[model samples]
Target: MVASLVIGILFLVLGMALRYWINRRKFYRRSPIGAESFSSYEKSVGIKFIERVGKWIAYALIIFGLLSLWVYSREKNDNEKQTKAVESTR
Candidate 1:
């Protein structure tokens, strides 16, 4: 149970970090263009790359968070069952 709690916390933190990174990347991409700017094609490509990377990171974080929640829930259910069984025997 303790281990599961730790792992769940880690996953939550990791998901938050990934979310922050994706937001930061998007903010950078959307910021105004300076006097020295890349061509339209180059800018488009950069934006596309950032979008793709951000999507992948977001997906990974979501999956990790879900898995952690699943594990925690399962552990809790198991503990509850054990307690009930012990009480019944008593």
Candidate 2:
């Protein structure tokens, strides 16, 4: 149970970090306040491909993390219910 919760939290943080990195990379790729080169604003095909792939990876990680947490909570609730029933019988 604890492992599941920890894993879920870890995945969630990793996904958030990955997303932040992708956004930051895109933001910084642009030209500064007054740039001389127009090429700085242009995104290469490779960069676009990486960004698209990274975006999907981040989304998958986030969804998997949420699902793990949901499973963990369900297990915890079931355990609690069994414990309560046992106590009531005693």
Candidate 3:
């Protein structure tokens, strides 16, 4: 449970970070001189790459967090079942 909590927190943090990065990139891209100042195709490609990577990272983090939550719930349910069984046996 502790491990799952830690992992969930980590994933949440990572997702937030990725979202921040994506927003920062978007802000710069929309700036008055952002795209206008870039003369090379390579620069555009790099920006696109960054956006894509950030999106993937954010998605992965979300998935990870969800999976962790599922696992935690399952564990909690199992623990509850065990407690109920013990009480009935007593």
Candidate 4:
């Protein structure tokens, strides 16, 4: 349970970092000349690649984190139930 929780937290943090990077890149992509130029500028192959792949990676990380947390919660509850049953029997 603890291991799962730790893994979940780590994945979540990594996902968050990637998300921040994506957003930061977008924010900085604006044209200094004018808003019109921002839309006119075409994305390079590398930037486009990162934008596409990074989004999927971030999504995967977040999903894995959530799944890990869910598993941790389920195990924790099961352990608690077993301990309670043992104590009651005594």
Top TM-score prediction, candidate number: 2
Q: Count the backbone clashes (under 3 Å) in each candidate.
A: 0, 0, 0, 0
User: By TM-score, highest first, what's the ranking?
Assistant: 2, 4, 3, 1
Please give, for residues 1-90, the per-residue lDDT of candidate 1 as tens digits: 667667767776787787787667567655365333345988878866876876687677767777877888898999999999999999
Best of the two (2, 3) by lDDT? 2
Q: Give lDDT tens digits, candidate 2, residues 6-84.
A: 9888988888899999988778766776322335335476677888999899999998899889989999999999999
lDDT of 4 by residue, 1-90 (tens): 799999999998899899999977877776776332233235465676778899899989999999999999999999999999999999
Q: Model 3 TM-score?
A: 0.80
What TM-score does each of the candidates earn? 0.63, 0.85, 0.80, 0.84
Off by over 4 Å in 4: 32-43
Alpha-carbon runs more than 4 Å astray in model 3: 32-39
Regions of model 2 farther than 4 Å from truth? 32-43
Global CA lDDT computed for model 1: 0.74
How many times do residue backbones clash in model 2?
0
Candidate that beats the other on lDDT, 1 or 3, i.e. the better one: 3
Candidates in order have lDDT scores of: 0.74, 0.85, 0.81, 0.85
Query: Which residue runs does candidate 1 get wrong by more than 4 Å?
Result: 31-47
